[model samples]
Target: MTDRSPRASRAGLILVPLLLLAALTACGSENDPSPVAPTAASSSSDPADDTAATEPPADAEPAVTLVDPWVAAAPQGVTEAYGVLVNRSTQARTLVSVSSDVTDVVELHETVVVEGGQMLRPVDGLEVPPQDGLALLPGEDGITLVNVERPLEDGDEVALTLTFDDGSSLDVVAPVRG
Candidate 1:
């Protein structure tokens, strides 16, 4: 003959309520959706927005005006030209590629510092951030080119065409500088 204990018999009584409590807790509370829709002003109320919006019309062609558009006035032995790029538009643009008559080939390149020191790295393209611009200037980091396949002589006018991400292009006359 076996005797049954009250504690064991009443175990289900305590366990059921605990299990129900857990199940209820597991059901997440309902969340009220936010009433406000996100907008540029609401999200990022930066003053730059006003400047960017007022600068140019949306449908205007991108002006790839080369800033300090000068190439090294080195002898004809020099095969590369260095300059800077500025996108004077509200919309973001990309430097897809550059072509110059001065050089047999032109490529969009970027510089990266590697290891203990700075190193030059070539990038397929560069992005001009919205409301801002990009620089192709030379630094301790490196420089980009309207690389001429051949050397450009002083007074030799080179045409550089910058292709935008939106399939638009800008022509800049890159002049050789001292």
Candidate 2:
């Protein structure tokens, strides 16, 4: 005699519709057809969707520009340079950093008053507004590049890359001026 348990019978009953549904889903329907919509889980895995999701943001500012870059000529073993960082952007921007390959250290420095006397101090950074400029004037008790580590001869050139607040960069060739 064949023995059939209640659980086995119930399992067989549930399995029939599941297999039928799988077969029907696997086959594409033609008549009374509706466009299939992608499930959210599979939709995001698409290559096109991944690209669109990773694309850079729009309304990003155009490239930044630097104008009239020049540095004062110095004697041998001179490591400091001074010039103007002019922002040619139509929008205001703050210079977050400056760097050069000619010097061991590059910084945005300013001269300010301190206890009992004036002092030349290094600034965290500098700001240059739209259509404006930041002056790096080296003078007595005034803002200047301190303790330069490289020799800047006349006609020598160095590239200064300025970073703006808007995640853009500009490279300017600042020549050593006489």
Candidate 3:
């Protein structure tokens, strides 16, 4: 297990990208200039719906965005992806599954504090709150790639697609490091 957050990636090729992410997150974007949430449509008094949100208008922003996405380096076996999942839309989204280019099996996992220590358990889905988000941190909630086909090394990248319950999906390239 590895700490994939930028705070833990303090060395090697990983630090450059993680530090940039930290700086950008700390500084904030120039165009929108909101807090963690982006500047998008506000909540409306409509019945809760997730299907219709499958596709957004060309001008519309993404319902969810991954901030500083990254993974821990590993020669093989399992590795977890970490990032802040920010849901910009008013409706909540559930991350049902994850597909990876390097691994055939990617499962959603949640870390729970047991009597002895901590344990990683498989979960059906990870929910992202409306106009809020969820953090995929190591030893916590995240997606795990089982039996990676190739070595995941520092500065390498892994392509992942996050499919939501609403039929929406987001493609991300997460950096590999320690």
* RMSD each, Å: 24.7, 28.8, 9.3
Cand. 2 TM to true fold:
0.51
Q: Write the per-residue lDDT of candidate 1 for residues 1-178, one digit (tens) a residue.
A: 9877644444443344345434543553212123345576745678766664444445543444455556666555433445445454456787777676666556555555578865566666678655343544543211244433555567777677777788878777777765
Which predicted model would earn the best TM-score? 3
Best model per lDDT: 3
Comparing 2 and 3 on lDDT, the stronger one: 3
Arrange candidates by TM-score, highest first: which order? 3, 1, 2
Checking candidate 1 for backbone clashes, the offending pairs are 103-148, 103-149, 104-149
Q: Which ten residues in a row have the lowest lDDT in candidate 2?
A: 138-147
The residue pairs in collision within model 2 are 78-150, 79-148, 79-149, 79-150, 80-148
What would you estimate as the lDDT of candidate 3?
0.76
List, residue by residue over 1-178, the lDDT tens digit for candidate 2. Answer: 9999745654454345445534644564322123456468637765767663444335432334443456677664444455445454457787677766665456656666678866566776567666454544444211233345666778889777777788777667878878
Deviation in Å, model 3, residue 75 alpha carbon: 1.0
What ranges in model 2 sit over 4 Å off?
Answer: 1-64, 76-79, 88-91, 114-118, 140-150
In candidate 1, position 71 carries an lDDT of 62
